[model samples]
Target: MTATERPDVRPANPHFSSGPCAKRPGWTVKNLENALVGRSHRSKPGKARLVEAIEKTRSVLGVPADYRIGIVPASDTGAVEMALWSMLGARGVDMLAWESFGEGWVTDVVKQLKLKDARILKAPYGELPNLADVNFDNDVVFTWNGTTSGVRVPNGNWIADDRKGLTICDATSAAFAQDLAWPKLDVVTFSWQKVLGGEAAHGVLILSPRAVERLESYTPAWPMPKIFRMTKGGKLNEGIFKGETINTPSMICVEDYLDALNWADSIGGLKSLIGRADANTAVIAEWVGRTPWADFLAKELDTRSNTSVCLKIVDERVTALSEEDQVAFAKKIADLLDKEGVANDIAGYRDAPAGLRIWAGATVETTDMRALMPWLDWAFAEAIASLKAAA
Candidate 1:
């Protein structure tokens, strides 16, 4: 059935999934029509559009003057792997793990790369790996925002200015919603499908001068794949940052990203984008304050993520349910919201316990989130009543 035809049980509000977030206010069929389709990506027009996107992104995001931005192979994961495989091994590596994504990167380093000297700094989900414990003498990998647990580092003040090692940051959900202190970050990776609400498949890699030096000077002992190789014979590939993708890209996705970027610009750039996210999250924060049964999953207020707000049912009654029953109950509430179309994909990550995850990304309006809060309350109440009857 069409969106307009959905039953009254569904709240009249848009969805707030973590990735593939809600499209911008004016995103429409006509916008898609303007996208480049069935066009040669290597052609002048295609290259020009690509360059425009890169420049627009830099302008909107306020990237540093010397940094290079490249459109890489896979989404954020690919860009991050490329950086890790290319620039690491010259020095001892420090892998920080606080959530699933960070843990995945650690697995890649120790298990996949088999790096023997890597240092691991870990914390339970919803908390940060010790920032002060990090050794500035080694290359460090970290996620600026923990999407699954809804925790984030408050700022970059902890990073040493004179540190010798590169700081690789996975800022997938953090890029547009939060201010990036670029001076402290060396190699940063993100996807189009995140805060911009564009299509996925390609990742954006931003490299600092130090990162470029590493790429040109030191190569990983392991064999480099063509896609991961950013330098040839000790020289950086300048064209890659100028819209020359390593492989063929979907121009449709490119144009869609451009659409999102344009929308971002129209809304007054990063400030406005962050404002929307902050406002959307505030709605949830208010709800959390009033709802005794639910509380934020993040441990501290300063660490709470504005983009992906994770919540857990705090009622002791929920803990009393069998593990399977608790999962079933949470899934029932998620399915109820999904069927109603008030929200979709609010279920927490598989590694996380039975909980709810709401995307309060910039593209999602505060009004939409406000409307969605009641629906969540209703769905939870109804699901709990059903579970009680069954019990």
Candidate 2:
């Protein structure tokens, strides 16, 4: 194939990175034209909007009725930190890390918090550690979906129904697109930048009745930062959970989130949202099945993430290169897509294996995913040709 005419069928929207992903299909600046940007977040209108975001999120995600949901300062990281700093150390901890984000949590618990009773269960990218090895009697901290590795725990069956301690989950990449087993989770956190495709800089923190109890009953020996503090007088700050955030929040982002939630509601709520992601993933999965040179990094169909779908180049021409050359080749494929205006930021994460990562959350249309496939093949060919020319 000589350098030929670009595919006429381009993705309508090619803004697919893993996070801060493509916004809702019809999103526009006008959607947020009425946001209370200059007003204080505590004002009646501002607070009402925030509360509406929380409620809409609850409705879309099907979070349990009793779970307490709140808006927090940082993205998903902030929400997880608050849960860890406010409610770890009363018991031993089991940290499961399959990729970068999960490993960060392990570092915090084992090295930063210096929890002597902590146990780390780790696996390389594209695989999950043995869920059965975890002792649910001890506090468990894990990511529901490994955004970097493209692997996720299949389900909550491994988590004991009657566990002794809390289950802290970093679900930034999973919520909304995947059904969370709320009964098995004590603390769940996600950023607005993920599946909903809202703006970044804020996180939603949901706590089960058990997680709140832990927060109220325990205090860590480490000094909790101002941002991580979730308790007042050793009791849960009920106001925060009711939409009174601990600090100022970007009203614009809140309004954007509301717009996204409304869009999600227009399409049939959670069940429909999950179906969208599944269909988008199926497009890529189908392509991978037929593409001779590429395969999903996630080997197990059950564990492959529907949102952050990672793929590896398996052609001998690409893989026979040195490690550094392999990464360069992967980058060239992604960069070729970018140069053609068919994709952007599709490169694998720095800490992840050399591959391509495409965001297939509900916000992304399956037609766009289908359109992107031919471009991916074109880019792969161009990248390999360039490498041969260079050699």
- Measured by TM-score, the strongest candidate is 2
User: What are the lDDT scores of the predictions, listed in order?
Assistant: 0.88, 0.92
lDDT for each residue of candidate 2 in 1-391, tens digit (9 for 90 to 100): 3323457789989899998999998999999999998899999998999899999988889988999999999999999998888889999999999999999998888788899999899999999999989998899999999999999999999999989989999999999899899999999999989998999999999999999898888878888888888889988888898889999999999999999999999999888889999999999999998889999999799999999999998999988989888999999989888887889999999988899999999999999999999888888878877887998
User: Per-residue error at 67 for model 1, in Å?
Assistant: 0.3
Poorest lDDT segment (10 consecutive residues) of candidate 2: 1-10
TM-score of each: 0.96, 0.98
* lDDT of each residue in 28-85, candidate 1, tens digit only: 7577786677788788998998899889889999999899998988999999999989
Q: Show model 2 residue runs off by greater than 4 Å.
A: 1-5
- Top-lDDT structure, candidate number: 2
Candidate 1 lDDT (Cα, 0 to 1): 0.88
User: Would you list the clashing residue pairs of candidate 2?
Assistant: none
What does the lDDT read for residue 275 in candidate 1?
95
